[model samples]
Target chain A: MKFGVVTFPGSNCDYDAYAAVRHILKEEVEFLWHKSEDLKGCDVVVLPGGFSYGDYLRAGAIARFSPIMNRVIKFASAGGMVIGICNGFQVLTESGLLPGALIRNTHLRFSCKFVNLKVENNATPYTSACRRGEIIRIPIAHGEGNYYNFVGDIKALEDSGRVVFRYVNSRGEAAIEANPNGSINNIAGIINEEGNVLGMMPHPERAVEDILGSADGLKVFESIRAACASLLNTVGGK
Target chain B: MNNDSKKAVVYVRLKDGVLDPQGITIQKALVQMGYKDFLSVRSGRFFELEIKADSADIDRKVDEICSKLLANPVIEKFEVEKK
Candidate 1:
């Protein structure tokens, strides 16, 4: 499957996503500049992490209006698969592809470290490779990863199993201390209601290599590959 | 050259139920400096915009920008004051 990694003005992790797909996943991937309106026929779109637009006005607020995001929004609405990491997650929330908003960290500091995330729901395409309740270690680096929304919306997200990942301790328990940015219910990631779009604060590309501290993040890409392959086969069979 | 400009100030604050870590930190600092009795604190930001006086429906335009770019409707509310 072809993957498109969007490169916004201040995007620093675009290469990470590109390399992970090209070298590690051995998939067809291309860089989609923010100014370009074309998606280049990519099956999946990856919005990499960085301080897009210098986090001006708000994190991901300005970048949300980039030309490519207009297409990304359309693509997402059409049920295309999209994965957003770190600041990319911020952009997704700002673009309204996902729900809620990421606010300032509860501790009022930038946190960068390896964090354990439990697979809250393995049913979605993003986490299908993960076993339910499995704990995966990934790196999270950000200052405004705190997630917030109305109490009712948060409850709805929980009730519907839209929460894909949750920060948790080593034992796979969601504990207050394990929440790096004070996200509600320790939400490390979530999938949109349609189940095609995913936004997560952790850097899965950064953790895909064993030398980088953890290889567990490869499961996410693997899950996407499996889902896409099955979908193609099902379509081609008809 | 015609110069008829008006300034509008937009203030954005997090919704009441949302947590404001920065505001809480500032409140703590106030207590540390030996100043108590401040029940609570909330932090917010503002933006200043200059619009042409001849612009029609300035309020609507300002409100549009506030909801679209200046503030996130899910977490923040913006107030615009024309001066």
Candidate 2:
């Protein structure tokens, strides 16, 4: 499976995600420049973490207007895999590929630390390898990771099982203390209705190695690879 | 004199139910400094835009910018004032 990592100006974690896929996951990976409209036929497109476009108007606000976003939207509309991490998550919401918006942390400070996340749902391609209610430690670094959705849409998201991950404690319980950024309902990650796209604030790529503190994040990448291969086999069998 | 140049101000604010952490922080700091007369606080942003009066439907254009770019309609509300 080919992975495409987008490199927007001010994107710092693009290489990290690229390295994780190419070296660790042993997959073909390419860097998709923000100005270019080509996805290079990648199976999965990753919008990595960073303060894209200096987060000028707002986090991921200006970057959403980049020329490549038009193609990204098209790719996602066709059931292509897309992962938006950190500021990438913000861009997803801004571009209307995902629901809800990320706002300022309730503490109004940049939080950088390892937090626990529970796999709220395991049916989506993104979290297929994760067991429901399993807790994984991942680092989050951002000032605007707080997730906010209206009460009505919140219910719809929950009812649809689109709430993929939530802040949790060591025992795999969603607790108030585990909520690092004050995100509503402690949402750490969510997938769109079609289950082709995932937008999350946690740095899963940053946690792909045990030397980096935890290797729990590797399962996320493995799940995608498994899902992609399964998809190819399903088509080949026809 | 040019007849096309005009000014428009866009005000962007978070919706009522959304929490304004920055504003709440500021309010707390004020209380610590002995200015506790305020009931609540909220934070927002504004932008000054210069547009062409001859452009097709300036109101519609400004509204589009506000909704699509200047303000996040999910958590924010925007107002465009024309002069």
Task: Evaluate candidate 2 and give its CAPRI docking class based on DockQ.
Answer: high
State the local distance difference test value for candidate 1: 0.93
Question: Going through the candidates in order, what fraction of the true interface contacts does each contain?
Answer: 1.00, 1.00
i-RMSD per candidate, Å: 0.6, 0.6
Q: Against the native chain B, what TM-score does each candidate's chain B reach? A: 0.92, 0.91
What is each predicted model's overall lDDT from 0 to 1?
Answer: 0.93, 0.92
Give the DockQ (C-alpha) for candidate 2: 0.92
lDDT of 1 by residue, A1-238 (tens): 8999999999999999999999999999999999999999998999999999999989999999999999999999999999999999999999999999999999989999999999999999888899999999999999999988778989999999999999999888889989999899999999999999999999999989899999999999999988888877977922
